[model samples]
Structure formats: structure tokens, C-alpha cells
Target: MKFSVFLDLIISGAFVLAAFLWYLASSDNAKTRREKGDDESITKAEIFKSWIIIILLCILGLGYFFSFIGSLSL
Candidate 1:
């Protein structure tokens, strides 16, 4: 395969892995909050931050996919 294709695969895989790890971390954080009875503001902040990162990751992944498609020969 071409170098571009290989590089794209690597980057895409990295993005997928990063998103999955982020999800796991967020899940753990929520569990910790529940167990510790964290403040409402803290919980809200964590949720907001996690959502923003997840949304950004989704957008970046979609953008990369479209760009890869555009680069294809057919």
C-alpha cells in the first residue's frame, strides 16, 4: 500500500484508540464522583468537559475520513 494510506490508517487508529480511552476514563470519573459524593458543580464541570472533548474527537475523526475519501483515486 501507498505511504499515505498507511499513514492515514495509523492516524485514524490513534484517534479511535484515544476516543475509547477517553470514554473509559470518563466512566471511571463518574463512578468516583458517585462513590465520593462530589459537589454538583464539580460533576457538571466534568460532564461538560468530557462532552466537549468527545464531540471534538468525533468531528476530527469525521473530517479525517472525508479528507481520506477525497484523496482516494476512485
Candidate 2:
């Protein structure tokens, strides 16, 4: 395949990997908090940060995909 297609695939893969890692981390964090009792809990800021990372990765992946498409039309 072409270089752009290959790059898009890589980006897509990276996004998926990042999302999975985030999910695992959040789950682990929640389990740990539960084991620690009611003294600790997840914070809004932490959730917000995770969302921000996911959003940024999604945006980057889409941007690369669009750029690949644009390149094809030129």
C-alpha cells in the first residue's frame, strides 16, 4: 500500500492501543480504590484528563485519515 495508507493504519492502531490502555488503567484504579475502602475515590479532574487524552488521540487519528484522503484527491 501507499505510505499515507500505511501511516493512517499506524495511527489508527495507536489510537486503539491507547484507548485500551486507558480503560485498563481506569479499571485498575477503581479496583484499587475499592480495596482501599471509602477513604478514597476517583476525582473529576482525573476523569477529565483521561477524556482529554482520548479526545486528543481521536482527533489526531481523524486528522491523519482526512489528510490521507485529501492527498488522494490531489
Candidate 3:
């Protein structure tokens, strides 16, 4: 509820959103590569990398959000 906590969530959400968009782009690239018989696995790897980072960022962001919210409760 505080300004800092809200800002933190916004930043975290930004990172998460970026990662998701990257994943989509990577998926499209992978599809294209597959169609062209290019490096299909590389695209898959990039998607996995982005997804993992997104998940980790979300976990950290949520942890921060909840901690701030918890502080407000007291």
C-alpha cells in the first residue's frame, strides 16, 4: 500500500512482462526456424531461459510485495 511497495511491484511487473514478451518472440522465432530447418533447439532453449527467469522474478517480486503488505498490517 505504501509508495515504495507499489513502485517495487510495478518494477517487478515490468520485468515479468518483458520476460513474457521475450518468450513469445522466442517462440515465434523457434517456429520460423523449425520451418526453415534451422537451429530449432536454440529457440527452444531461449524460451526455456526466458520462462525460468520470469518465474524467478515473479517469485522474488511476490515475496517483496507480500513482505511490504505484511509490514503494513502491523
Candidate 4:
């Protein structure tokens, strides 16, 4: 594989990993908030936003990874 293609795969993998970690963090934060009975905690809108970000990141990462796979085949 070319250096650039390898780099792209690495970046895409990073993006996917970041998204997964972000999701886990968000879930843990919500659980902590619930357990603590915090008066001021993450709102529904914030949760929704986080989910959106996670989804977008996954989409971007997968898109790049698949495109690179195709290129490598050529």
C-alpha cells in the first residue's frame, strides 16, 4: 500500500475509535448523573447532539476506509 493510503486508513481508524470512546464516555456521564441525582446535568438536547456527532464521525471514518480499500485493489 502507498504511504498516503496507509495514512488515510490510520486516520479513519482514529476517527472510528474516537467516536466509540466518545459514546462510552457519554453513556458513563449520563449514568453518573443519574446515580448522583445531580440537579444540573446533561440535557436531552446535549445527549442528542452527542449521538449525532458520534454517528457523523462513524460515517466519515467508514467512508474513508472503504474508499481506501477500493483504491488498494487497483
Identify the leading candidate in terms of lDDT.
4
Model 1, residue 22: displacement in angstroms? Answer: 0.4
Global local distance difference test of model 4: 0.85
Q: lDDT for model 1, on a 0 to 1 scale?
A: 0.76
Clashing pairs in 3: none
List TM-score per model, in order: 0.82, 0.64, 0.63, 0.83
Candidate 2 structure quality by residue, lDDT tens digits, 1-74: 48766687677668767877886787677667667773443544566677788778777777776766776677
Error of 4 at 15 (Å): 0.7
Better of 2 and 3 by lDDT: 3
Which residue window of length 10 is worst by lDDT in model 4?
38-47
- lDDT order of candidates, best first? 4, 1, 3, 2
Give the C-alpha lDDT of model 3: 0.71
Residue 11 accuracy (lDDT) in model 4: 80
Q: Tens digit of lDDT per residue, candidate 3, span 15-68?
A: 667767766776787788789887767767876886787678677767766766
| Candidate scoring better on lDDT of 1 and 3 | 1
Badly placed stretches (over 4 Å) of model 1 are none
Write out the backbone clash pairs for model 1. none
**Pairing residues by index, what is the TM-score of model 2?**
0.64
Q: Output the lDDT of residue 21, model 3.
A: 78
| Candidate 3 Cα deviation (angstroms), residue 56 | 3.5
